[model samples]
Target: MERQRFDSHQEHPPAWISGYHLVYIQEGEGIMRVDGDPLLLKSGKVVLLKPDCCIEMEVRSGKPLFLYDFSFTYTMISDKPRQAEKVALSTGHHMLSAKAAVQLSLLLEQLEQRQGIEEPLAQWKQSILFQECMHLVLSDPVSSEETGGTREAIEKVLLYLQEHYRGDISLKEVAHMHGISASNFSGVFKKHVGLNPLDYVTQLRIAQAQRKLKASQPIELVAREVGFKDPLYFSRIFKRTVGVTPSIYRKHRHTDKIITLLPHLNDYLLALEVKPFATLPYGGNDHINGYLPYLARELQETKLTGSWNKPDMDELVEAQPGLILGSNWFPINLETVKKIAPTIPIILRDDWQSLLLDFARFFGKGDEWKLWMRRYEQKVMQAKSLLSLSHSSRESVMILTVTCSEYRVYGGRRQLGKVLYEDLQLTPPAGITTKAHYVCVNLEQIQAMNPDHIFLTTNNSNPSKEQIKNLKETKAWSSLRAVQKNQVYEVESWLNGHAPIKHSLSIDVAIDHLAANRQKPWEAIGM
Candidate 1:
């Protein structure tokens, strides 16, 4: 490992290096070429080189540059039984996350400190640290000019895989057709898609199997049709992924009594007209009791299992639910939940459309889902037409949520923002271009954006309400154009989750507020 520093700008003469090389830029800007492929460099950029690659570099004139150049030779073991093989690293530039950059910096520093050590123990430690550095670089998604072709190839390959997943497909053959090696194709495929190529194939097969099983297809026939040769092996994989055997899933696909562990997910089940057998309690001293106010009417018949922190295990067992729905927000012990019933802990992605479709397909309610979407789309069209009549569609809007601690500004991708910015085609305030779920902002930042209208919601707690009350009294709040125009409106906190029912309800809330005469400041502005 070598830490190379250029105190002053200089063009380096081209040189050839042996073994695999990793060049990490620590600071400053420059351009480096590996075999005439220009790689722009800055902080956190890495340049990987295959053995005997010609290297050339130029630092930005008058700027100091610091980088680490590490070289090593290694071979990877093959997954195939009785096969050991060597795989070369794909040479290119890659970008690292800030956290990973910091980690790599420290590892390189340690390796450099002990570079001269010859003792076996010290050498072993150095080897371990070098391996760690290699893992960090190789594991990162490749980002380079050289990788552009690889990315395009992988995308076409992905489409091909999806189109022919049910056939007897060999990933190696597919990679060869795309002009990429089998091993390299796996890494690139995973970078584009979130799963390994083989795992993706399995997922596609199982999803098809599920649809077939629900249609009363024989187990062996279903397995063979979906690319699985062994029925017993298929059953094991199915049980592991779906949390129930194929027979059990098919039997209870339509008749399962479900218990919802997450508060917001109740809206999803109810939207599909599947009333949950039971649900966890929702409110505290500051909001409506029992469940979310918007969903409470429909969920009245559903049993309240317990509070989120302390669920009633006895009631869960007594409900005899065939399944339990949980989410990333509220975690429960997998073993504990499985002991009662098959549990599906969904990872919430703040995408209501996809969530609704997935649940609809899972429950064999595809037609119901399509019908629901048609109605929702009709509602959206009506709302958009109404807003256009009032010219509110042309105005920029902002959605802000206040908790006891801080104020959050939602972006176009989350909560009410999705309805306003995407569905209704309303403009967002200037300088608010983030696609993230939200960003915390101060009153001064909010004043700077100076949106045409503001929609505010608060946490259920009284202290949160008090914070909103206090915010209204501040000079920063009083000076806003929306406040002066009386365009500020109070909305429900329940409108903030990405549930299908809640998303539809939020559109109603938005249109009602956007088209109405601005209510008096004292009438109903905040909590």
Candidate 2:
């Protein structure tokens, strides 16, 4: 072992070396790129580099990097390799605790002291010290279930797999992408993810295939779309993983007593005209937006399910929904939920129209979705006509929601934002879908925007009288044209949305508040 310092790139090291090298940092910082993935390097961090792995570092300019480095090669029992073999092994990097840092210092000191040993007996003693030091240097379990290692990283990887399973993804590519060894990544991935990495990928493809199959996509097209080059092979894996051929799963998918967890799923189900058996518990939370009042009333006779992201195993089994419409937040392992019912994990994206169609396919409700769409279009025309007469000239509209002690301004693409800006032919004074879908701003900032009109939604079941009285008294609130003209008013609660029906209803509500003020926050619920 040796301590060294490098001030610049003048001394260019090879991209990678022959075997594993354990480098323990003492000072300075740099950015290390492994197979093009950048990882931050800092004091007390130890990086274990594997054989043939591409690595490059960008050191902090004018700062020297000080560290101890050692390298070793491993061989299986009863055999000695003449050249390094491409075998799967574990490698990791970590920040050391003070106790571990001290031990590493001592190990390095012992190795430095024994560098000149020549006697056979002395050599044996030196070998023992080397092994002990190596153990201390490489003892961390980067991806081990026994160590209860970081689970968040693995979950991120799982979500990536869910989103991109149709692409040509390999275990080695993912392991390297995350800066870990293939073997270790495989072990922990299976342990926490409940399937072998490749198996998980395969199941994801099969699930997508099932969706396409239900939609009546050709078998060959489904195979190609899901990354399989051969239709027969895809069918084989499909049957093996799902216990049914793609044809069978398509012919019949679990479709009754539906439950949706995320707003997108809930909205899509509502759009299909088949009320879900249950939905996420939102009525009591500080999220009095959207059509939850309607959902709450619907769920009175129906069951009220917990959030899909949080798995309450007993509660889920008891609810016994025949089909569960889940989002990415759903549990990775649905073994228990599967025992009670089929759980289809739907990855929610920003496009809601496509989302509604996908839900229709899953539940065999394409006809119903068509009927709803036809009616929704008719309703849209009626709304447009009503607005054109009562509210002409593309009036500037803003949607500001009150929650807790803060306020959130919705972007043009948000549920009700779409209704006002798209269907009802209004203008968003605050740019269309410009900010994050939801942007938090204070009262002064709202005054700066000074929208001509504001459709406020509060998380409170109804805006409190005291709060209302106090807000109006503020000079910032009184100066806006919306407040002066008494045009700032609460529309319907819009918490449960992201589907066609919700947007359709919100379109009506937006028109009512804008053109007629029938359900005005001050009068409808006495806000």
Candidate 3:
């Protein structure tokens, strides 16, 4: 056996004796002519050749091919004839014997040692050793179980399904591809792969759908992209597999305010639909800027408004608002606001979703509010389902909010953390809170938690390279799995603070960065 490493710029072999040859692609992808058939070879892939078998190579442009090539001849041992046979097969392609690699390595070492030696005895010994190696190589049994016919068939189906998942691929077509009847193929496939053909395809479709959803594509577009003609049908299937609608899934993935309002619309409406004269006094601070003014304007445009903005206490005796929309941030005196508009209803829009719902209710076109509300509900439910699944799956994460002086480790109260754990279905660290924007924690707490990923958010102040390096080098931080795996992600505070539509996109970026190294398919889906 003889071996040599070939570079991208190396000259082709001269027209000469082509005996048993084996090539291992270490890096780069290319096309190789094996036995006169063009075979695609990717990195970490290998090929084998027989005597007089024509072989050629074509590397992808800009990607120089790196390969290990071995050529050898075999002689009969103990009067037994040598024969070539397939060893391993994957997706219709066969692989050479595993020992081929070992033999090739040793042969390469021998050739290197005799680089300039042309002595007849040394050459004879090399030839004999090469023959002996080839004899041992060819004599090894091709494990029928390793690349069995059934495995080949299954791989073929998997590849085909992956390639045509967005098209109309039927069971009959798959079965016919392998020259088997649908019924027989179904039985064999199920017995061997543990899933019926259709179920397998659906699973693949769901995986693709999850990816598309995480990418923030609209549910309808995701349905169409995944080959589902009916968005409702797609929703049903997605809910069945993921236990949430796609819209909800996308919404829940982010810690936006909309997720909160989705589940509490009735409460919101109940608070908003009060009689003006019977309303309580709004006691919030007048200095605060709430959505009240905007709501009042919208109500007036819709023919349902009155002196609702900056109303005086005496106004309670005369004209009153039909409704009062307020939130936790409402600065007006809640008592005074309600009392001045006694007949008006006061609705609290504290959560992000509630604000959207409130806006839709007052400003949306006729019946459009209802549609929007329903969509919001779907989004929330989907998020809840994902959170439940993530919990069940035992996937863990860490949420960190970056600030100017130090980073704040949200301990379960931050809306973003809640959304990650309770909506998107990720198992956030138990200490993280969602009650406020973010909280501060030292490196000691992080080391103890040993989270799989760290979700970090930064304000206008970006951490300098030195700051990041110092943080990573801290004694308490060095022990953290996330840090060890380089999973520390810097997020923008605006994403975690503002309720703008762009918040959803920010959440996606955070998930992708935090879950960059996660191994599970769902984590990858979130990414």
TM-score of each: 0.56, 0.48, 0.31
How many steric clashes between backbone atoms does each model show?
0, 5, 52
Model 2 RMSD vs true structure = 24.2
Evaluated against the true structure, the overall lDDT of model 1 is: 0.77
Worst 10 residues of 3 by lDDT: 255-264
lDDT order of candidates, best first? 1, 2, 3
What's model 3's overall lDDT? Answer: 0.51
- Residues 11-67, candidate 1, lDDT per residue (tens digit)? 578989999888898766566777886656666778778898788887752446778
Candidates' C-alpha lDDT: 0.77, 0.65, 0.51
Candidate 1 residue-wise lDDT at 86: 75
Write model 2 residue lDDT over 71-100, tens digit each, in one string. 777654434646646564567676665456
Off by over 4 Å in 3: 1-350, 365-393, 411-414, 433-437, 462-470, 498-503, 510-527
Query: Candidate 2: which stretches are off by over 4 Å?
Result: 1-255, 262-264, 285-291, 296-300, 305-312, 318-321, 329-340, 430-436, 461-469, 516-527
lDDT of 2: 0.65
lDDT (0-100) at residue 26 of candidate 1? 75
